[model samples]
Target: MKTALFELADQVLFQNYGKRDLALVRGEGVYLYDDQGKRYLDFTAGIAVCNLGHAHPGVTDVIERQARQLLHVSNLFLIEGQVALAEKLTQLAQRGGEAYRAMFVNTGTEANEGALKLARRYQYVNGHAEKTRVVALPNSFHGRTMGSLSVTSNPKYREGMTPLVPGFEVAETYEQAVEMLDDRTAACIVEVVQGEAGVRPVDEDLLRRLAARAKELGALLIVDEVQTGVGRTGRFFGYEHFGLSPDIITMAKGLGNGIPVGAILAKQKVADAFTPGLHGSTFGGNPFAMAVANYVVEVVRDPGFLERVRQVGEALRTVLEAHFERVTGLGLMWGFDVEDAASWRKRAAERGLLVTVCGPKRIRLVPPLILEEAHVQEFEAIVTQMSRA
Candidate 1:
């Protein structure tokens, strides 16, 4: 029993996204309700954006209050909310005694795009105008924007979009990526945990090498934390897990829970290169987005809140480890191997659970940060039944 809305959606909308047959109409806590009123335990969390969960009361209140107080204004004015959020992010980003500064955008792609510009600009201002090449690791997923796509390593993501931004190149292998960093390199970008690579954590030894080499070569070290920031990895930022203080950071996925807000954080020395007219966004830091993002940062940055996430994430990990092979990830973000992932996802949905298929054989689990130990038990039960089936 499907609705005409699903049919209409296929008819009118761009079919860029491969969608499931189930049509979710509403959500609350960790559950989604379809038009037919079947309840589903939501483990995907809207692809990791709803870090706080669905229809969160606090987030709803902020949205409503901001809607009444002020919705949007041009970036021309000084937005107190944006300033407050920037201060919070930069403070959280401070590492090894070097403070950071931040700027807002609307998505992860935009954040990375701006970070790239800042990287080249920082070098140009410092008399290294030829340092314009960016080196990216193999199997990295930054975003779909032209600039971010150029730095992204997956060849499949670039199909039908070749001749990408020149000077942007992916290293032949992960080892070669760091080896390629040099004086001519403007920046080298990486993901601490390569999410799309089946949730593989980048090799720490190589990461350390990359950081050291970037410093030695005067190339900026940029960590793409869009999918791993905002306490997703049980640390304020994923790079914190490795004790690497990156020169620039791009984040977006979980920052505002489900609201669209992204940011670029840079060491002040590098940030200074972007003068008044260097880069700008029209609706980047509107009052509405800032208000929600500020609140999300406040809640996720709490020490106690993050500790609970670590505990619960481990509990969930134990369950996945027992049943699935190659279960890996950090904090609440995890990926496991399965046979026929699409079919497995559909079967799980039939039993009232929902998950994401990151690849043909890789299933990624990015449940909300608010997920409790009891939720793990519930997930185990559903998995047990699926195994029996």
Candidate 2:
């Protein structure tokens, strides 16, 4: 069955991803069962999408119930689920009762695209028509779309996709970032934690300074919290840790706990820039995705659940620090430096563990929020055995 699936995939699917050998058949909690019935600890958590764990009862129930009711409806009509999710997101994003609005999409990249458009439009309508320049950090990953890719700094991803949308500049230093936020700057986008660049957290001081500078220069500060939001960084939004109140914030991974849902929460002034005909997504806030995301937001926003994530993160870091040479991350999002990450990942997979290698020599662990102490212990045992070997 695995071979057949692989063959079919090769024939029918795009050859974009580096296909893995094993074909997963089922999942329960933190474990995945392959076609041959082998249980593997899922540390990757579907690239951090399954925050509540695979087939979580609550998420599954929502999906099943919503599927039976309604799935997709064009964005022209009013959607109860979409409105509910947006209201929940706005409330969570702005705790101080600040006016905020949400625009939903189907993926992180779409959310970012929406954010970029919002920033540009805000600046344009607010009499800064020349503010079309965008600043991005050097090692940031926003998304794969052309608009988002233009701001992403990875040379590998941007190699062949040249002549990118103009007015995008990469800030090599904090000072450069300040200079880049001049009068022509539309927005400066940054990730709270650089996920694909090896899970490195952003410098708090630099971020704070940038925020101030952007505000002072009349450029919007766009926080790309696609990987760091949704309680992944022990906060409803990662920017909260840095005490930032960004003009626009983008989020996606884990927002639906496996359901495809992404959104951009923005201050009312900025959000209002996007008029009805200016920006729209055909299936952005579909009922099915919104229903699941509403449930995910309720569970992830709970104070107790977020606190548990913090505790588990600290415990996992302690265990990893004792074994690995270097560890870095916040909450459940972590990465460790290794001698040969690719080889290490292969060996770890052989031992029934799923992990992803980033950069050149870092292995990232973005496990489900439902991960327990026992799961961390099991991972520790695997690492200990591998270290000994």
Candidate 3:
């Protein structure tokens, strides 16, 4: 069955993704079963999307119930699940401050695209129409869409996509960022941790300074939490670690545990920039996605759950450091500076362990937030054996 599927995929599917040889059929807590029922402890968690682990009963129950009830309703009509999910997100994101508003989308890229639009619209409506330029950091990965891609600094992703969107600038250093934020700068978007760029976390002081400068220059600060949000970094949102009050926060990956859901949490003041018809998504906040996301948020927002994430993350790091050198990242999002990342990843897969490579020599591990010490120990045993080999 797996071989036939592979042959069919080769003929029918687009040749964009470099997928692994394994064709997984089912999943349960921290594990996946491929065709022929070979079990592998899943460490990637579908690239950190399954925070509660694959087929989480809580999330699955809601999905099944919601699917039986109502799946989708266009934005024209009011959706109960959509409104409830948005209210919950705003409540969690407020952090004891002013009210926040949420605009749901279908993916991380869409959330970022919405954020960019929100920032530019806010500047335009406030009579700062000249503030149309956007500033982003080098080694940033925003999205693949034209709008988000414009602000993404990696040349490989943008090589053939030009002539890309204009008014996008890349700042290589804090000094460069300060100079880039002028009267013409509408927004500055950055990831709290550059996930695709090898799980690098930005310095807190630099982040605070950048936020201050953007505010002083009348530019909106947008934090892209697509990978670090929803308790992936032991925080409801990654910006919390940096003490930032950003104008816009975008998220997606783990919001629905597996369901496709993305959102932009904007301060009420900035959210007012988007009026009736400024932006809209046909399937953004549909009922089924909202239902699953609501359950996910309820689980992730718990104090005990977040604390456990911190503990588990620290343990994972400790175990990895004992086996490898130069480990980087926070919480479940970790990367190891290895000598041969690709070959190491291939061997680990062969040994029934799954991991991924980032940048050139960084092996990234963005396991599910529901990971246990036992899972980490299993991975450790594999690494220890590899070290001897």
Predicted model with the maximum lDDT: 1
Whose TM-score is higher: candidate 1's or candidate 2's?
Answer: 1
What is candidate 3's lDDT per residue for 336-362, written digit by digit as tens? 888889888888887888888886788
User: Lowest lDDT 10-mer window, candidate 3?
Assistant: 171-180
TM-score per model over all chains? 0.98, 0.98, 0.98
Query: How high a TM-score does candidate 3 get?
Result: 0.98
Model 2 per-residue lDDT at 347: 97
Compared with the true structure, all predictions reach lDDT values of 0.91, 0.90, 0.89
- In model 2, which regions exceed 4 Å deviation? none
Q: What is the lDDT of residue 214 in candidate 2?
A: 90
How would you encode candidate 2's per-residue C-alpha lDDT over 1-389 as one tens digit per residue? 35688888888988878776888889999999998888999999999899999888988988899999999988989999888988888888888946899988989999998899899999999998999999998888899899999988888888888899989888876568777788899999999899998998989999998999998899999999889999998888888999889899999989988778899999999999998799998888899989999999999999999999999999999998998877889999999999999999989988999999896789999999988999999999998899889
Model 1 ranges off by over 4 Å: none
Clashing pairs in 2: none
lDDT of 1 by residue, 1-389 (tens): 66788888888899888654888889998889998899988889888889999999999999999999997887889999989999899998984569899999999999999999999999999999999999999888889989999988778889999889999888989889977887799999999998888888898889999999999999999999999999888988999888798999999989888889999999999999999989999989889999999999999999999999899999999999999999999999999999899999999999999998888999999899999998899999999999998
Name the candidate that leads on TM-score. Answer: 1
